[model samples]
Target: MARRQRTPRRTDDNLPSAIDRFDDAVDAAWGRVFRGHPVADRIFYLASEVGDFSVLWLLIAATQGLRSDEDADASIRFSLLILGESLLVNQGIKRLVHRPRPTPTEPRPLHVRSPMTSSFPSGHASSAMAAAHLLSKRSPRLRPAIYLLAGIVATSRVHVQVHHASDVIAGAAIGTAYARLADRCVPGALP
Candidate 1:
């Protein structure tokens, strides 16, 4: 019998393929609920917005803040560390996939602007999920707010059409896994 060659799956092939269908449904639902409401649209818009330079500075500040904290800040510091690591992982994946933005050739409208870079595995959604998972684990009371924010961040990518539904889903999974790994490593780091 002749051997059949197995082709390697592209990194993008590993991303969630169901995002288009799922996003359509989600968009339909949101369209019905927030129809013609500028405030609601703006809220959704802001939720998905990522100031690249600002986020980089914030992450740097967060790491510095964590390092400065004493025993009382253990949980917060741990969570930030986990989230930061997850964001790094997400960045790596984005580079590996190197998928183009959802609309590569078209001129994006003002409100729908996004960076002209790779778009598989959204960084914003990844960071938001990492923070939400870590915070939820550390403080039960904050779970609702954390999850709500994560959901909004994930949905925002689709709202602006910067990512397909699959990108956010994969980013969320990666972020969650990184958060769990970080949590496990944190306790061992303490002398």
Candidate 2:
């Protein structure tokens, strides 16, 4: 028999590793855990709803008048910051990153409405964190509550299968950075 030449297989470093796949795996795992839990679905649905731009605006409108003039001013500025950050994250960074959403292994009811944009840094988490960071600065007494809401919103993103854990983490970091920069740019923006 004639011998045939052997060729080596090429490896593409660009391919995702198990480490890189960890986020998606975690997202899928969370979806599996919350798949049929009615209470969890309801809570996550509500939490995600609070992060919607329109819902956030309503929240601002409802509470703006209840606080002092300075506090109200801070709240308004905080909302503006969130709006700007959302725009930047959704339209700019998301497109650049182009990270696709996690594909669930099985069909399950989503707690929140379907997402339209690419999933990398979550808009909901970004807005939630921005609001929490700025609002907490405006009212130190409400810091814990503000963070709790933000945490809920961020967690809901994962549970609802709209975002990976890393997506929320990136969103939070970006949001906090933006808030800090906004405060630095406008000295009184935080409080």
Q: TM-score for all predictions?
A: 0.66, 0.81
TM-score of model 2 (CA atoms) = 0.81
Worst 10 residues of 1 by lDDT: 51-60
Model 1, runs deviating above 4 Å: 1-36, 50-72, 75-83, 104-113, 188-191
**How well is each residue in 105-182 modelled by candidate 2, as lDDT tens digits?**
555565457787888898888877777777777668888987888888888887777787888889988888877787
Please state the error at residue 85 of candidate 1 in Å. 3.1
Model 2 stretches with alpha carbons more than 4 Å out: 1-19, 57-64
Q: What is candidate 1's local distance difference test score?
A: 0.62
lDDT of each: 0.62, 0.76
lDDT by residue (tens digit), candidate 1, 1-191: 99999998657753344555675666566556753467766766677664232253244334534544542364446545754664575556766888766642233233755566578777767777776776566457757976887788777776666776677787788778877777687664321
